[model samples]
Target: MNSTAVSVDRNRTLKMIAREFYHGLTSLLFPAICIVCDQRIDEPNTVVCHNCWSDLKVLSTDIVKMKQIPEQLDTILPVFEFNDTIQKIIHGLKYSGYKSSGVHLGRLMAAQLPQDFLLKDTVLMPVPLHPLKKRERGYNQSMYIARGIAEISGNIIRDNVLNRVKNTVTQTHLDAHERHANMQNAFAVNRSCDLSGIYSIVLIDDVFTTGATMNAAATVLKSRGVASIRGLTVAAPI
Candidate 1:
């Protein structure tokens, strides 16, 4: 009986090893391409080439923390300005089916979070997607970003705590006021969700542009008794 148990454990371990090897090989076969230049990269793990990586301007966390929110936005932070390169990359990730790029950008955003943003009991709640759109996309980009942030901050990701109740139009075309109006009544706390213990959270997203999205999300979280809410994004329009 003991021999059989040992053999089972060994098989499980081998299966895990095999899975890793297969994943590695598959990644190498495709190779990650630079979103900007469309060149095959030597590093299969990162989306941007070495030159593009160096070109990306890492926005200062201090500036973000101290930056004044415009008349409309309550709180906001963007790690990079929205330049042509950034616009191209974000467009590809959001509209062009380059899903892996979300992971890379998420990591960059994670690196820009304030040092103390990940408090002792902080949670990561990404902006939720509408049900139908999420189904079409196969996954939420914000959730992907949250996963990358989770890897670095070691914060618990509570993905299903909030959900989009309305399928709204793209915010790209809306003005600040219209954006807020469009998102009105769009999200709600999950009916069966639990929020009794969480004290703080950092809402993660791919970019911070109009600040409308973050405001709406934070409003919902504040209503749930969360004490502190901060926003983090990979790119901000600045």
Candidate 2:
């Protein structure tokens, strides 16, 4: 090889070595543990250990009914039952800032979709957090999950297409009726975006509780001329 080409190759190799060494030091200082089982994770960018991941209980392939789902939502698909393991994984991602957790869960969520779930022109939209809440959390867990789904499914993630106009109270302690009330009119579509070619949308969220939030998001999209809207979530109450 020419001198210049040889120099470039040497630089590339040195850079790769430095990057791996940095990652190795980081891992040693802050070991990655399985979100579910608390076992040490040797593989990079993995949330759950191999055993816990395999032990995760996937809901049956059949579509399950969601209580209080909005009429605007054509379907709601949840990958796992809201069991202890799933709960911890979600809590880590949503509250603990373990962002890598979303990648595994999101891929599982995408894998659970039906063979024809996403149409050719389907867009993935994550449920938006109110600006203040987003600021407090430092990140939107749903958006990260949607990104993971996009990574696996090759679907476009249109996060800006929807906006949460209302800063509602947390729904964690709310009853079914209270949740519906709190989420009413919480979302609206961004009028500036040209969604002309999008045939369908898969609304993404971290969890499906009373379905109030997902339904409210779907309502906004329907009002903005979206025809078909579906919901995808990591876990739901069984």
Candidate 3:
């Protein structure tokens, strides 16, 4: 073999060894535990253990017809019902810097999607976080979730298609009507983004409470001449 090829193989082996060593050290310092049950996680690359994962109560097959969402969105797909287990997982993803939890949850959500849900030219757009908030958090949780979905569904994620123009207040304490008022004109399409070839858009978020954020994003896309918009969340209150 050529010297260059041998060098590349050696570098690859060193990287693999370094990655394994890091994971091993991290595990020794901080054991992987299930967010919901606080049990030790023996598996690699998993946030929640197998037992807790299996115990999660998923949404019924008729979830679309069961919940009443906003009028602006075409449809909303929720993978699991809002409960203690889901709440802890989402909290870890959003507040505790546990991004791997978001990816795991995103994979679960992707599995719940219909077999042919992603069309040939569909785009996955995550709900945008304001510049200030994003800087504070160091990462956009929704973007991580979108990445996981894209990884599983083989779809494309266009993170720059939309921008959060308004830094709205948190909607946790707000009622449905208040949430609607808070998200008004919060999003705008990027001027440089060309939507000519994009056939559809799927708005992704971590949790759905009032559906205001997703609806507002969809409205912006519609004004930009996008025909179809769907919503996907990891969990929602029934």
Candidate 4:
């Protein structure tokens, strides 16, 4: 009934219409194609087709539970195996800047998760990227993944709570011990963050390798009074 409320509604409607028009125009001019299969896809937001998506192997609950959990984390939830189609997808998301793909992968993970996997009031947080790495990458790939999970699960996201203070060398080539050492003192709780009523958090990432990154981040979160901390990723090695 108020003029301000009506104006806000009008603006929201205009934005939806504009978004639809842009999608329609882009789809018409350059139809979306599946990256894995190279088949034309109607969905503009995703680069991989449904068939290719299904090609990713789901990790059994036993494997997920048995995976080496960092001492600082309460649990680890890995949805898919880090091989084949998923490997290609993560490669594109991390190396080629296909952030939408990361989001899609997170959506897939949330959809496939068991009914009682995530605890109530569990906030989702992406592992922080160092300032230098973030500048070079333009965006944090795990943030988009967390965004997708939030979209599907209706969970809150807290991106500013954890901060990456150390810009260590990439762990891709590092052995297990090397990775553990590389991530030491890499993260710290944000100085202004008050962990008052927040009890649980799930750190999101694209893959679970040695879990060195999650371990480092969780150590910082636990030290800051977060009661429950867990790790969730799209894929993990068998």
Provide the overall lDDT of each model, using Cα atoms, as 2-decimal numbers.
Answer: 0.76, 0.84, 0.87, 0.89
- The per-prediction CA RMSD against the true structure, in angstroms, equals 5.4, 3.4, 4.1, 5.8
Point out where model 1 deviates above 4 Å. 1-33, 60-74
How accurate locally is residue 16 in candidate 4, as Cα lDDT from 0 to 100? 100
- What's the residue-level lDDT of 196 in candidate 1? 79
Tens-digit lDDT track of model 4 for 59-125 = 9988887898888999888889888788888888988889988888888889987777666688999
Model 1 TM-score relative to the real fold: 0.78
1 or 4: which has the higher TM-score?
A: 4
Give lDDT: candidate 3, residue 237.
Answer: 78
Candidate 3 residues 15-69, lDDT tens each? Answer: 9999999988999899988878989999888778888777767788686567776
Put the candidates in lDDT order, highest first.
4, 3, 2, 1
For model 3, the stretches where C-alpha displacement exceeds 4 angstroms are 1-30
Winner on lDDT between 1 and 3 is 3
Clashing residue pairs for model 4: none
Model 2 Cα lDDT, one tens digit per residue, 36-77: 888898877777788776776877655365344666789888
Model 3 scores a C-alpha lDDT of 0.87
Error of 2 at 59 (Å): 1.2
